[model samples]
Target: MANLCVAGGTGQVGRDVVRLALDAGHTVSVLSRHAPQAGSEKHHDGATYFAGDVTTGAGLEAAVAGADVVIDCLEGQFGKARKRFADGGVRLLEAADRAGVRKAVVLSIINCDRSTAAYYASKSAKERVYQESPLETVAVRATQFHSLPVAVFQAGAGVGLIPVFKGARFQPISPLDAAAAVLEAALEPGSSEDHRIRTVGGPEVLGMREMAVMWKSVTGARGRVVELPLPGAMGRYLRAGLNLAPGHAWGRETFVSWLEKRRETL
Candidate 1:
């Protein structure tokens, strides 16, 4: 079994990666700001937790020591996003290279380079860091998560109406599905030396308006979806379907299916 270290393993998608990696029988280590105690979530799953912060390079070398593969699921937003996502990645790669780690993997947003949004631009920078780093690495780009649109709609609920972008296209995959894709990238033979970008997305491409309606139906949200044509460079990019990966829709989870599954769990 390989020694796999997950940076930011305590996050929503990162947790899923750690779980799946553990299930695959790899010696899993979680690098987070706070190492969980014996009974905590990170420790309970048979993963060794290491305290580390990639942004400032604190404790990273120790966490990355002897790692065969390091999967980065770090996230951030706005101006800070570039630092946390891109700069942090550089720091992590430096540590991984010094520790003699063989392979590295980083997760990024699909078509982030084509978008003008601050967050997407930051993600694009992060992808570039992996591309330029000498450490064997792959940048896997995934479409938006299922929870993203739901959060947008929920946030838009005001005066019994949900306002959403009229033509925004999204191929929202489940977070777990994205995590599985990342694991596949990590385990692929000789994939570490391949620096090409790999894209993965959901089974279906749905508009923002349609996703908003589904969110209302699933959560029984008391609001009607109001489609508004977003006018901006960012909106133009989204409305053009740049976010949808038509050639790489490898995920099986649909928006409605994911919602139904969650409903059963509740």
Candidate 2:
């Protein structure tokens, strides 16, 4: 079994990746700022947790040492998100190289190249790092997670209103599906020098209005569904479906099914 390390394994998608990796029977290690203690998710899932910080290059060497594969699920946001991703990614790659890791798997957002949003721009830049570096890396760019729109709707409902972006389209896949894709990329057999990029998305593409309605129905959230035209270039890009991958609709879960399952846990 390969020794796999998951960076940022405590985050949303990272947690799924860690769980799936453990379930797949791989020896797993997770890097996080706070070391995981006994009875924690990592410990219970049979993963070794290492305290590391990618941005400052602290403890990363130990975290990735002797790892056969490294899956990067690191995330950054806001004005400094771009610099954090670019710099931290380079640092992580450098550490991986020192450890002689065989493969580097990176998770990114789909259609990041087509958007000017700060977060998307950072992710697009990070993808380039894998391409430019000599590390054998494969990037799986996935559509927004199904929880994204749900969160938006829930936040709006907190104030008794749902803001639907006019003309916006979303094809959100389950994080589990995205995690599977990342693991597949890491386990693919090939020369370690090969660099590949794949795109994955949900089975169906729906307008923001449609998704809002679905959220309302599934959660029984009563609120005003206010359709508003989003302003700025970011909004224009979203309205144009620049964040979707229609051709790579490999995700099988529908929003309705995801919502139903989600509500059952609430």
Candidate 3:
């Protein structure tokens, strides 16, 4: 088993990565800005947690020390994403290199470079940071997670209307699948000088309206699906299906299946 370090391991996808890594018998260490609270949903018993800020390099050395690989799942907020990702990626890579880490894996968005949106731009920048580093890097560019649309619909549910982009479609993958891909990449034997990119997507691509309707039916949420014109570059990006990777549909979980599983939990 590899000594794996998961940056931002307390977040949604990161939490799954931590769990899966631990399940695989890897020595897992989680790094985040704040230490995870014991007994919290994000905290796992087998993994270690380090409170470190990637943006400023604070506590990074300790977090990454003695690890063989670092899976970067760091996330930044809106408007501040560009600086946070760009600067934080550099610091994280430097710390990993100094710790003699053999490989690094980053979780990124599919077709991030095609759009000029602030979030995509930040993701693209972070990818560059990893690719340029001396350590072998694997960039896993995945489509939207199943949680994304669920959050969108939940947010709009309060107002009695769920907005669906008129021409948008999604191939949303489950976080478990994405985390599995990351683990595979981390374990794959490769040259130390190599930098690779992989894309993964959900089993099926469904229209925005179709997904919203399915969500409503499964969750019993009361809301009318309202089709709205998604204007601007982002709209064009989504309409063109730049956010999808049908050829790399590696995930087995469908949106409905994920929803059904979630409903059981609730």
lDDT (0 to 1) per candidate: 0.85, 0.86, 0.90
Per-prediction TM-score = 0.93, 0.94, 0.95
Assess candidate 3 and give its lDDT: 0.90
Candidate 2 lDDT, tens digit per residue, 154-265? 8788889998888888999998889889988888886645788899999899988899999888888899999888898678788778878888998889999999998864
Instruction: Give lDDT tens digits, candidate 1, residues 159-210.
Output: 7878888778889899899999999998888753548789999999987888
Badly placed stretches (over 4 Å) of model 1 are 38-43, 79-81, 191-194, 264-266
Identify the runs in model 3 with alpha carbons over 4 angstroms from their true place.
264-266
> What's the lDDT of the predicted structure labeled candidate 2?
0.86
| Candidate number that wins on TM-score, 1 or 2 | 2
- Clash count, one per candidate: 0, 0, 0
